[model samples]
Target: MGWLDGYVALVTGGASGIGRAVVKRFIAEGCTGVGVMVRSAEQAQGLQDEFGDKVLTLMGDVRSPADNQAAVEATVARFGKLDTLVGNAGVWDFFAKLEKMPIEKVAESFDEIFGVNVKGYVLAAHAAAPNLRASGGSMIFTLSNSAFYAGGGGPLYVASKHAGVGLIKQLAYEFAPEVRVNGVAPGGTVTPLRGPVSLGKQGKSLSAIPGFEENVANVTPLRFIAQPEDHAGHYVLLASKENSCATTAAIIQSDGGWEIRPLR
Candidate 1:
């Protein structure tokens, strides 16, 4: 039997990239059903085409409390209960330095980055907390190397991710003994991770940056760039109470050994 057999989960930003991989992996691990929160109808349609009724696709922005609540309610309504809430939606700052940005732009970018990366997680946790507590389930958030170290992105993106570290810790403390809270921090992965609109980089993706893969591989201790799937198993491990029952307020780093990267 799969680790998540009979379990139900909700994954925000589940339409593409790491979120999509997590949804697929959760299903393969025998999740009875999965609720996917996406940004567009096209993404919902794509998920439906691929997973059919196995997935409940909700088109909404993660930054909205109403949308977050709706996603949780709809998931439990369809699946009978909620077992896991994966907060995986986020935006990059495209490495825009603080000094380089126009004063007005910094404020806008900060809001947009923190809105999606930090506020989104908080909203999801708030919306899913009751259901997850009822089921004695867990919460998992997608973090980044920026959460721990520097150079991952600009001040806004990095600081937002660092804020996630605090959120997970505090939430884990608050949810204790009933619901577990944790995170997965992935390093440089090849994905369509977009940037903040305020920086005029909403259309830019990390993977499209010329030589990004080569640059990441050269610096990463593992000597290779990761794919979204490379980090999916960490989510499974954390979500499976059977495996990680003793773990909470913990973050699994699936970032190509970034912690041990050679000093330059």
Candidate 2:
């Protein structure tokens, strides 16, 4: 039997990239149903086509409390109960350096970055807390290598991810004895991760950067760039209470062994 047989899950930003991979893996692990929160109708349709009734696709911004709440309510309504909540929505800053940015742009970029990365997770946790507690389920958030080290992104993106560490810790503490909270921090991976509009980089994607794959591979200790699927198993491990019951407020690093990268 699969680890998540009959379990129900909700994954924000589940339409593409790492989020999409997690949704698929959760199903393969025997999830009875998954609620996917996407940013567009097209993405929702795509998920519906691929997973059919196995997935409940919701279109909304993760930064909205109403939207997060709606997704949880809908998931519980359809699946009978909630088993896991994956907060994986986020935005990159495209490495926009501090001194290089216009003073006016920094504020806007900060809000957009934190709004999607940090606040989105908090909002999802807040919305899913009750349902997760009721089912004795857990929460998993998608963080980044940026969460621990520097040079992953600009100050805004890096700081936003770092904030996630504290959020997971505090939430784990607050929800203990009923629910567990954890995170998966992936390093550089090939995904369509976008940037903040305030920096005129909403159209830019991380994987689209020229030489990005090569550069990441050269620096990573594993000597290869990761695919979205590479990090999916970690989410499964964290979500499977049978497996990770004793694990909470922990982060599984899946970034090509960034810890062992040679010093420049």
Candidate 3:
């Protein structure tokens, strides 16, 4: 039997990148049904076309409480029960530095980033809490190695991820024995999470960190960039009752050992 054979799952940002991979992986695991909440109608349609009846696609922004609630409700309506909520929607402001960035600009960064990453997770969890409790299910968040290390993002993005770490602990405490809460910190999956990174005040691109190919070959010990599928098993494992009991508040660092690289 598939790991999620009898369960229903909701994945936010499920149209592309890691979110897309998670959706694809869960379906392969024989989930009873999969619902993907994305912001773009075009993207949602593509997913619907690809998966046909086995998947449900909703077009909505994670920043809206109504949207979050609607996605949860729809998942239950479609599959009859909701067992897992994967808060995988996140944003990164890579094109600017904190000091040189204007206050308004920084605030915009905060709103865009936290709106999806933090508030979205909380609202989705709140909406799904009842159904998850009924199924004795779990919540899994997609975090980044930035949560632990500095320089992974601009100050604002890094701070937001750190907040995610706290959210994991606090929610785990709040959810208790009936529902489990955890996070997976990925080092660098070759997704579009990064963009024209800014230097100090010049809006310079931070592309010097290393190209995707180089990051895999020169930085990661595994000597390869991770595809989204590389991180999918952790989600299945965390969602499984047998494998994840007593595992609340835990963070599985699925990163490629970048945390230990000696400063050169």
Candidate 4:
């Protein structure tokens, strides 16, 4: 039997990037059912084409509590139970340095960033709580190195990540032995969450970070940036009953070697 032979999982932002990778990983590990809550109909169709009915695509905004509730309800209705909820939808904000950033930018960016990252997680957990309690399942949020360190994201994004770290602990306490809550912090993975794309013409030049890719590659003890698939295994491991029964409120840092680089 596969590690997740009878598991049913829901992945927010599941049509692309790390979320897509997680969905693929779960299916590969023998998860019996997987649902991907996407933000676009075209992306949802693409996932449906790829996985047929084994993957359910719900197009909804994570910012909406109603949408989150409906997605959770749809998953349980389709699969009979919900074993895992991957809160992987988030946004990045760049243009706003704390001092020079506009008040509107701060408000808009914080609202947008926290809307999906923080509120979405809370709503998803609230919606999935009873089902997870029934199955003694887990919830995993895709966080970033930004949660622990600065510079990956600007002021607003960094603050949002820090809040996510707190959410893991808070939810873990709330869910307890019945349902586990945790996060994965991956450093320099090539996720679609490129810095501040929404900032348009005013966004920071990601390429200007001084040999950003090569420097990141060199700094990591692993000696390379990771692909989304590289980070997916941890999700499977955490969701596995045998491997993770004793692990909860844990933040698995899949950050290559960002935490231990030599002083430069």
- Number of the top-ranking candidate, with lDDT as the measure: 1
lDDT per residue for candidate 4 within 1-264, as digits (tens), equals: 678888999999888778899999899899878988987889989999888888988989898889888998899899889999999987776435777667776676667777777898889889889999999999999998889987776778788888989999999998897998989988876655645333452244443455767866877888997888989999998888888889999999998867777777
What does candidate 3's lDDT look like per residue over 88-202, in tens digits?
A: 9877767347788788777776777777778888888898899999999999999988889876677777887888999999999998989999998887776655332222222
Q: TM-score for all predictions?
A: 0.99, 0.99, 0.91, 0.92
Clashes of 3: 2
lDDT of 2 by residue, 79-111 (tens): 999999999989999999999988888888888
RMSD (CA, Å), each prediction:
0.6, 0.6, 3.3, 2.4
Give lDDT for model 4: 0.83
The global C-alpha lDDT for each of the candidates, from Candidate 1 onward, is 0.95, 0.95, 0.82, 0.83
Lowest-scoring 10 consecutive residues by lDDT in candidate 1? 195-204
Among residues 3 or more apart in sequence or in different chains, the pairs in candidate 2 whose N, CA or C atoms overlap within 3 Å are none
Model 2, runs deviating above 4 Å: none
TM-score of structure candidate 3: 0.91
Show pairs that collide, candidate 3: 94-197, 95-198
Better of 2 and 3 by lDDT: 2
